[model samples]
Target: MSVTRITDVSEPLVAAFANLVPQLSSSATPPTRDEIADFLAQDGVYLFTYSNDDGAILGMLTLATFVIPTGKRAWIEDVVVDEAARGHGAGAALVEAACEYAHEIGAKTIDLTSRPSREAANRLYRRCGFVARETNVYRYGG
Candidate 1:
């Protein structure tokens, strides 16, 4: 599998967005084409897609890096692999790519959160050298 940064809005990417949203969240709606274009245009946000030899997208993730008063940080978000593509390294590839990119950009640390119910995903993260932190994760709004 190969991972590539998505630089522009295209039909294939729009289709991939449609295919991935349901996998990422059952309650969240897929972003519109304009929203995707806007996202791609945002500074410090990197979107990557994992694909096979035939160039079919198997997974995607976004890495957003920004500088705060403390230091530069990177967050891996919206990670989703096609249901049929799970267990075949697409997820790992995406995470590795994101981590590498974050390092390249001088991020001090990369962070991500996974639900406890996602057993396999949690395990995958552990295998990729992610340690569970003893901290509270709070969300403000729906």
Candidate 2:
């Protein structure tokens, strides 16, 4: 029912990630408890979870923030809502939370990338105030 940043790792969070990772990326494996703990411990890396009133986690997202010569920057990554919970506004809530955090952290801009084939998600991002940009996003390797 609400979005909150995760500061500690727990079995419920571990299990939720196990269920959500594949939904985010078929080729990516879910992180273990220790891995999640390590990630949470990293500076400027944040993990937020959206859970129902009964404490059932329904969606999650990562917000990474950093400072450089230009200014503060944030990236919203790996946003995914549970398949059954898609239409109930969890994705929008998660995104709004991240954007608020980005503003709090003084980030001038927040960025995210979605595959063109994910039409619904792309539309959601646009509706959430992200503008499409013409730029090449190059990965270091395949």
Alpha-carbon runs more than 4 Å astray in model 2: none
Misplaced by over 4 Å in model 1 are none
lDDT (tens digit, per residue) of candidate 2 on 15-125: 999999999999999998899999999999999999999999999999999999999999999999999999889999999999999999899999999999999899899
TM-score of each: 0.97, 0.97
Clashes of each: 0, 2
* lDDT of prediction 1: 0.94
Residues forming the 10-long window of minimal summed lDDT in candidate 1 = 50-59
Candidate-wise lDDT, in order:
0.94, 0.95
Report per-prediction Cα RMSD to one decimal.
0.8, 0.7
Clashing pairs in 2: 1-51, 1-52
